[model samples]
Target: MNGRWAVGLVAGSGTPSERIAAELRRRIVAGELALGARVPSTRRITREWGVAMATATKVLNRLRDEGLVRAVPGVGTVVAGKPAPAAGRSREPQRVSPRASQRMAERMPEQAPEPASRREARPEAESTGARRVRAGGERDLTRERIVATALRVADQEGLTALSMRRVATDLGVATMSLYRHVPGKDDLLRLMMDVAFGEQPLPEPPASDWREGLETVARVQWRIYRRHPWLASTMSFTRPVLAPDAALHTERSIAVLAGRGLSWEEMAQASVALAAFVCGLAVHFEREAQAEQDSGLSAEEWMDRVEGEDHERLTADPERFPMFDAMNRGPEIDLGLEALFEFGMARMLDGIGLLIEQRGGEGGGLARGSANK
Candidate 1:
């Protein structure tokens, strides 16, 4: 890795991440950036290097992967101890002494707590209670790490269990420190939603068949909701999260319907309808997860305990509900969410197909004759 960095730097040619990582690496090895001192954060890196957030994230990730730096909750990313002396180099720079390192760390400016009056002036800031400093001395913390940790917490524990304190506890940082990067829980949730939606990217050149494209979009959302069961609850149909990546899903849906012999209104409704169906069905996922967690029983087990009594009650009046009794006696139905999602998606697409056909049949020489061809 050192050899690669040397060559890349000397040649002045490499990916943005490589060049940036090399620069940071040089600072760490030279002891220009002292051990345990906070390194430039992702935001700082973006500002200093003028790189995109994605590229900045990659640079930090590469540094992390190489073990040159580590993220300290509340403090941000800092140099991970001092780099070891290179082998067989008599001229190698001497490692900074512990005393000198301590002095350097002390010389680094600390971030004082924000004043209460100042915090109160921010309209969106919610009171997260009195802040507590981390037990251990401050380590480096970063917004990227905070968001990633918050995402994990939401995924495992569900959103209701999430809070600024919850994330701070998980990060081993003071609750107030998070406010520096994320203003409040609302902003944190938005960042989490953005990261989640950006996980899957749209296909280049897109699918030629509108049906295929729409199906792809629906399935992608289903998979995303399945992975983050709590994601469905965060979404709003009317007042959606201001996440650009999430909006791309809607764009893709509408793009496929372009020139499909439908009015602008019809196209817009079709896109929204597809999203509504997916979100409506997906709500069950988080609810079921929470139910299982709280009740300590899987859906099947919960149903098993109740089904016997319910079945008997319904079957007792067999003549009144003959078909219901017979069907229950026959095969066990797969009413699982995954099964329902598939059934709903197929049926929804069928409805959309009918709408397209109906629009084609309307008077005034067809809205777009190309749809039939």
Candidate 2:
């Protein structure tokens, strides 16, 4: 396998199933398996590879995990196309700063034309009572208010339920009026993510410990996902939201690690890993919560069904699979999801700590390799 795919797979390796998963991923990325081609069925893979059914299932899941393949209901698993580049990739849409606006106008003189239309200003209405003296008129709706209301709706319902019409109805305004605030769904979602990031209470730097600082940030992010379950589904790593608050959080995270003496490359990798860990955990948590709500079955009850099958499998093979037998004997696995998150986060931080120490010994500066710094 190429180094890139090898590294990708190694990062996720922990079990035999995971190792098989890694190999499958390596194959897919290396183009050993073509795009749009169907992956081998579980039975075919099991017979061909001489692995168990569970292992084959895990392999397929791993491909799905990396977004390599997707199931088409009755059609089975087929490879997914690589995503196209985002429309805004080339020209980053910046907030209209005075300097930027001036530069644009200079470049395109036609855009500097006089204002073409005007709305008739409303005449001031006569005030009526003591209440009018005490209170101001209804606050004019702004972009912030529009985004806040949209976020609230997304929090209560999933992102799938959020729409321009729905938000307009909630705000007691005509649907066309919303266009004056937010142009479309994409614009609203971007603003909502920005507002959500703004809600986090970031600590002032030089944090006591880098790990602790990161953990705090991750926990705050977890809280956001817990409150707004749709967030996990909406967030995109490839097309990051460039809102000021979101950018500030990224800046803070990098600053926390700078104290550790890590190089720019190391810090960048660490940042990506930290984000993936939090997002991955949140996705699973949201999925489990949704499953419970949909089925009305507690987590324990769901585990019981899997445990029963595991028990039956153990009875059939006590000698051939000693590891499986031992696992069965151990305390019921809660998937160790919470513990896994902490453990993985700590391990990643520990690796960064070691790198920091190495860089410190070499008398290297934190900003030496970073572009943003």
The digit string of per-residue lDDT tens for model 1 on 1-373 reads: 2555444453577787778887888888777876766677665566566667667666765564344565542345666544446676332123445675566457643322223463333222123423345455136678888899888767754665467865775565778778888999999999998898889777778787777788899988888887888888888888877899999999999888888788888878888889889988998888876566445457889999999898988888999989879988898889898898877877777678778877773221222332342
Off by over 4 Å in 1: 1-139, 361-373
Candidate 2 local distance difference test against the native: 0.59
How accurate locally, in lDDT, is each candidate?
A: 0.70, 0.59
Number of the top-ranking candidate, with TM-score as the measure: 1
Candidate 1 overall lDDT versus native = 0.70
Task: Estimate the TM-score of every prediction.
Answer: 0.60, 0.56
- What candidate 2 gets wrong by more than 4 Å, as runs, is 1-140, 319-321, 361-373
Question: Which candidate number maximizes lDDT?
Answer: 1
Question: Which residue pairs clash in candidate 1?
Answer: 72-140, 75-141, 76-140, 76-141, 77-140, 77-141
